[model samples]
Target: MRSSNLLKRAHSHNKQTLSSLLHSRGTSPHPQPDTISGHKLIEEETNPNYKPEHWYPARIGEVLNHRYELLVKLGYGMTATVWLAKNIHADGQSGNRKYVTIKINVNTLGEDFQKGRRAIAEKLFSANPQHPGYAHVRFMLDTFRATTKYGDHLCIVYDVLREPIDLCMKKFPGSRFSCGKLRVLLPALLKGLDYMHSECHVVHTDLKPDNIMMGLGDPNLLDHFVQHEHDHPSPRKAPDSHGRIIYTSCSDFGESPTEAVIASAKITDIGLAAWGDEKNTKPIQSNVFMAPEVILQAGWSYPADIWNLGVMLWDLVENIGLFDSISTEPDHYRPEQHLGLMIALLGPPPKEFLARCAKAKWYFDADGQFKYPKYVAEDCKFEHSIHRMNAEEKDLFIDMAKKMLTWVPEERWTAKQLLEHPFLTKERECYWDTPSLSRASTASVGSLIPSRQGTPGLGPTSVPNGSIHHSSLPVRLLELVPSLASSDATEPRLQRQSTNGSLKASENDEKSTSSSTLPLKPKMETLAESKGESNDETLHKKRSVSVNKSNESSQAMIDAILNRGKNHAPKAPAK
Candidate 1:
């Protein structure tokens, strides 16, 4: 798959280069696609095939509302384009100019625009200033209609913000933020989520990386984002034709002055957020961040936000997507595969939760295996447990992931509940010492070590003999020493020899196992040899006893261990 993608990209690159050369010499390589004429509605914005008219020919120094001047385009989304503009009336204060972000809705009469306007207006009018999340939420300053050459575009003004958290992730790559930084950012996000759910009675249906923007305090990073007037389909310069900048009215497309601001983290873009009581069967959330309840058409509320938050945190920390929805096959079913991934990483959904799901049969059977195996082929390659952290930290995070991503929406932890979890609270770092019975009765997260046992198992949830099992080795050690159990069927058997000097493998199997066993290397023997100084006598006796035991089978592993004795200087045979 990777090679195929590289080949295709190489072909495209060569083709583009050839085309560029031809175009430079007054020859047409390929005809351009036709552009469509329209009022630039939602269909135009969404359809890749359509080329809608620009809502704003936003140029430098364009003044709006007799005060705000459009300086640069910060970003754009489905229904709106946000621009960084300066306040002409406000004087500079605190070493920063009073800059604002104006979000102009593409079509004022569009349904999305009206709905968003109503939602924001309602929240602002009734919003509690004392709410804890208020500081984290983007502050909406004003709203008005900007009459352009095309039509009146609805515009909402806000204090200028830095880049979104996604940009921050891209900037820092692996370390999205240090643990110290996370301690600050995550708590603020949780506080915001708690306040929105409990006090504002709102559900932020779309809370992906793009929605969570940075606060203004960081370096100015908007120059590259701004679209120059020459780059626009039509530059609304004065009729002088020399293209000198000019401002006609509060309605005209003209240049705006600029200002600088720094960045931090804040929750923005509440266009899709809904009242808590609103009921609908429509889909919400970015595909990769979609909760199981949203996919199953089961009802959802605050907990759904918690699920998104958890996944986002994973992406921020790990620098990789926790749940990838990209389909390998063109015909692959997404929901089935997404659910399969959830099950593979966590565990099976509760039967009662499955009973409530309308499409449960399509995804899971009575025994919890995926019904459509082909659709979820991607999940087949995933390990049952997260293989990234130490046993303790791995246990801690998986427990948190499980709590946020439960099959039952009701069973998932709320933002407030999660904020109190030991993973988030510094004071409760040692809380794992107290065995809190897991929400899932089957097993606690610490027990589920990723193992070679064909099926990854919760390691000795209960020891029958009250003695430690071989599997009880620290997960770190298990990682270093590959488990024999997960190897090919014909591989040599590996079992602990009895302390009474009996060999673990039977004699009949000895011949068949030798060729299958890995070759012994000097470096591999160092681990076994480090335990004792009188190593030669101990090694010689073990080899002799293993060969003498009729019950013993393949001595490949024992031979590998004993071979280390040969690598040592023929130390004077102990008298």
Candidate 2:
């Protein structure tokens, strides 16, 4: 007993020493008043190496101010391209690789809808604003690069995140994360969402596993050898001669004293999210986890965010999305399954809510008339997949999940309510703290894949952005052909590059490419003038001229925006 007590005291003393080490660096793992004050002193600096390329930035060869070499393409969505890059700035002095992931969104020829969303992202980014509750989502590096696919797409240089959370968990399947870590990440995510909803008044509209990133454990995704700063810090290693280490760093751009306070995952991809899209009044992206109120065109609010948060929480706790309905038609996605999920867990929607759904044709109408179907199938049983769940577990998921994913947007759990839920409070385990979390399998999602047919509404008619002209997600793309190598998929795209940075489309690309890859109709005016079908589209648009040179929303863009306003002037808030 005496020896055991000595051991306990030794552990305590060592922990205190580690705390002092971190504190001496002026970096605290947790936000204490004194540490928080220190953060205010870190100022943004101009990295001499930063530069923008005018060419269609693809592959690792595109020029980034002629310093950082784009290495490997990490991932790409319809509109964004993620790449693993190496800092040429090192001049090979350290012989060590310092890597960062660059998220590039090309600005091809101007399309009103496309440009509008880009405009919002640009405006928010240029302001370079930070919310106290969020982890600092700094524009670590930025540059403008033109691409033929869209005309010059704005390329944003950011510190790349390491890997998918699922991939991380798989590596340590038997490991369990501690409650202290969950305390760190969940509050950060909530802060990001909260910032978007209240401060920016925009909804992410898309939140899923792939979008969330991890700092250490899964694989050194950002560890391209050179030192890089990421939101999540990497474990400390013995210092090298240069006094720098690779892989991880930290930031608290958004967090305040409140752990659950929402932060800035700023409503990105404005091509799909409009400022006044109160009712989801227009077309947008498709997928599971998107809230029903959003799909039904039934006037969504911050609650749509709650639905997404619920989906995230459930998956973290049980490793399964509550409803993961994929389809082959209209781009193989569905959100209507949310109703079935709702019904199974909370029982049928109240008649009044059903009435609201019935009147909304584009979202829930049957007969394949509108985009998504309204009603649930008869056998829907909202059973969660938590292995041997007891009654209390059922209450945890069914009650909270249902509350967050409720039919009436207003009825869903507010961010505050989600914080109060038993599931979040139950054990304090975080996805990160799980020791065996990294060893889990990616294929073993708790929920089985749903049928390809569910709700309606097609994905964007044109490729969204950064979506390879003919490519699906990289996961789906790689899966389509078992034998093709990841590098092989990119080789073909690189072969067509012009000596001067243009990608001369091959005869096959011209024919097979979706219409979105083609150049826009000749603009009678400059990019800003020709931005929107009318001004209404501008809600999602963010137009920027080379600010180092001029200031004013372009005439053509302004005219197009005004024109769109006539078609759908946003509905004013209800009394």
Candidate 3:
């Protein structure tokens, strides 16, 4: 079967299974309740660290900036609550209603942090908007402040997007992306990273699955979502002691996305991003994906993001972290263990590299031997870990991984260089274009624009003007990589030799290929449609909803909650 057909079948099976489950439970697939008893814990209220006062008390129907109207809760995090909102005052010339995502920050953040965030946002906005990778980035669109009795809240806006990539991965079989999907995803991801590193001079310190979100390919989907919410308001918890009503977050975007929608995935959550020039030892990145330099307190720059992405690929493909042994307790991070795993897989770091690390002495002795040598797991070899790919595919993937996972940050491939890897381009051709299966090509155009009532995942058929050709990439960008060229000529100093007395093909390997022919372009519609803040903070895990309650009983519970709220005399809406 063709890959596209397989994807469609998978989506169909998932939808059918969901419908069956909902039917078995005697409830609608999209259930909306007016209210639930405040006694019932939901979402953020269940968070052990949740503080009511720290959060902005945003109501479902409340209007912000006299323009955007909050429709429903989308998600929440440590720092803010995200809402799907409708723009009441869109550009009159277009006469089209626009939907946007609003991230309302908590009031508890310090003034200095707030100012720094604003400064970073400004720097992101100043990046070359014309860059091909610009569309692949979830850039901030607008910002304003909302005032309340508790404190002032910062409101940042962005284009309405679907669920994060991490959630999307669950829909796929084996909880991993198909090679076809990876081909579409990785190139776009790398392009966005390149734009951040080279054109914007920004380093996205956080590059995990949660930070990458699937873009809504059709604007009509947003319209449908808004109409759905208007017709059926989401169920909300009754007024709490402070009159706070928490609504069940509705993050689903109706149906499963087509390959094109998946292809349009964008890198998001620049909240932890920093300027590349401002290299500092301040610890950043999620603990598992933390680069060696970061763990060692060695100053890092854009190359750190390459290592982060390299580790993240395992999560995307293997459905588990590559460095699972880094922490003995699931909640606690062990730097020594992580370094040990790195050494076991990639061999010992060079003495020169360790010399720059402030914390190297804590783990390594005077001669550079790991003090805790027992921590190194001999079986933790990269070749032995990957089980899914064929030999050819595995070879290409390992080569790409090695390029990005080096101990010396400078030895890691730039995002642009990785874009040309055979794992993405050549493997895509072999998988998608096999002669045995005949169908319309499923290859992505590497760019997308919103279309009205289009086929699933299909974007505009023609490239827009000002589309970027690979050949047109500036020479200076290529010239800036003298270290990579020099490093490629010699064997990598850090690679471990296998017991067979031969080094793995992943180490110090290079393949010469024709220049990338992929046509790159900005999403023209995104420039206008995109708006919103990054909800990059850690979010509370979603609790499963029970479907056992009958509609009549549910209505009765809502009515009782309403009567209870009335007796207490809930506070009036804010002005």
State the C-alpha lDDT per candidate: 0.48, 0.39, 0.63
Instruction: Kindly list the per-residue Cα lDDT of model 1 for residues 248-300, writing each as its tens digit.
Output: 11111111111111123567766667666455456677677778878876666
What TM-score does each of the candidates earn?
0.58, 0.48, 0.69
Q: Pick the lDDT winner.
A: 3
Best by TM-score: 3
Tell me the deviation in Å of residue 373 in model 2.
Answer: 12
The residue pairs that clash in candidate 3, if any, are: 157-531, 157-532, 157-533, 158-531, 158-532, 159-531
Q: Which segments of model 2 are wrong by more than 4 Å?
A: 1-62, 87-99, 106-115, 122-132, 136-140, 147-151, 174-184, 216-271, 276-279, 325-338, 355-384, 388-394, 425-575
Q: Each model's RMSD to truth, in Å?
A: 20.6, 25.2, 23.1
State the displacement of the C-alpha of residue 404, model 3, in Å, after optimal TM-score superposition.
0.7
The CA-based lDDT of model 3 is what? 0.63
Q: Which stretches of candidate 3 lie above 4 Å from their native place?
A: 1-41, 91-97, 328-331, 427-575
